[model samples]
Target: MNANEVLLDAFGRIHEAVAATLQGIDGDSLSRRPAGTGNSIAWLIWHLSRVEDAQVASAGGLDQVWTSQGFAGRFDLPLSQRDTGYGHSSSQVDAVQARPELLLDYYDAVHRQTVEYLQTLGDDDFDRVVDTRWDPPVTLGVRLVSTVADCLQHVGQAAYAKGLGRKPD
Candidate 1:
């Protein structure tokens, strides 16, 4: 009924959706760009995880799970260590090839990290500013909410891409 509990529920949904979306999907299908130009399902999920990892880590003043947990090295794409898939080009999207389990494992690590971070916060903690780059500055609460929205949106896109039911190559 409290803020943390509510956040836990929302984040729990993300975990479930992620597991469902990636289930049984292989790497080629994951990386397939719809019509050969759109964001691949792989890229969407990866970006979603990256955004959550980056924002949550910043809000918590902790290290990103991507680097700290060796995901950057494991993924091993020829991208910057700080790459979050934001504004990545088509070729950049193509560079993010990953197996389903690898993506799921990375997402699971980031999700667990996010859960741990959320568990320690009180309602007042959400009011703390986490980013000051924006016009109004970003608070922990806004950052978390934005992350939830962005995550769900990307996951939904992934699901829809899957539903397009293009024959797996």
Candidate 2:
């Protein structure tokens, strides 16, 4: 398989994990934090989707699905449109609550945009530098890989938190 195919496969795995983690979870369970300071399953999925949407869309020179697709309105989240859950305080995390379907819809929308963007890239496109802040700079391929890695980590976290039950009041 070519590089694009390989990359797509990696992203596909992340999507599968996300779906499995979210399956059968009710809104209450999704909003529950395993520990007082920990993130909830809902927050994990929402953050992952936002990160992927923002990072991938920026790399592709496209508007983020979050705003472009009206998810911000649908979610009506307390945070600003630019919020991607980075360094979110516990209060901010607690502000994120949604039904499982809405959470999955956002994730699926972001994933669709990600896959569509990836499909447009030629082999050489992957070599294009997308970030210069890093010491050696980062390529489009590397950036996409990083996105996948971050999403996978969050998916795993959600899965773990899903099993931990709600934090005691």
Candidate 3:
């Protein structure tokens, strides 16, 4: 497979893995911080989704999807707030909580949008450097690969947290 096809195939499995993790999470478990060590499942999901929104929007020379929605007003500082990396506000979390289906929907939207955008590119676009809003100078393809890596890593974390309940075996 070529680079784009390889990325699409790998991301397809990552999508299934992420969906398995999200579906296994009970509502209460979504807010648990796991001994106060790091972000909860909800926070992690928000972060991952937002990362995709931000990165792809940057590539397209548009604003991120989350910011346009005024998500900052949903602040859930201190306890559920994220400090180390991107996270959602309290309202954003509530929004996500209100619609469990939106979790998968958002993930699917970002993934599909990214793949479609990449499909429009030629081999030249793969090497074309773009100054990313979130990262330093890197080609669009490189940035996308990084985003896929991020998604895969977080899916692993969520799977481990889910114990024996993870699916798609």
* Number of the top-ranking candidate, with TM-score as the measure: 1
Which residue runs of candidate 2 sit more than 4 Å off their true CA positions? 166-169
TM-score of candidate 1 on Cα atoms, chains taken together? 0.95
Question: TM-score for all predictions?
Answer: 0.95, 0.94, 0.72
Candidate 3 structure, TM-score to reference: 0.72
The residue-by-residue lDDT of candidate 2 on 1-169, one tens digit each, is 8888988898898889889988888877898887677899999999999999999998999999999999999999999999999999999999999888998899899989888988887899998998999979999988988988999899999998887764567
lDDT of 1 by residue, 36-73 (tens): 89899989999999999998987898999999999999
Clashing pairs in 2: none
| lDDT-sorted candidate list, best first | 1, 2, 3
lDDT of each: 0.91, 0.90, 0.64
> Clash totals for all models, in order?
0, 0, 4
Measured by lDDT, the strongest candidate is: 1
- Which stretches of model 3 miss by more than 4 angstroms? 67-99, 132-136, 164-169
| Model 1, backbone clash pairs (residues 3+ apart or across chains), number | 0
- Ten contiguous residues with the weakest lDDT in model 2: 160-169
**Residue pairs in steric clash, candidate 3?**
74-90, 74-91, 75-90, 76-90
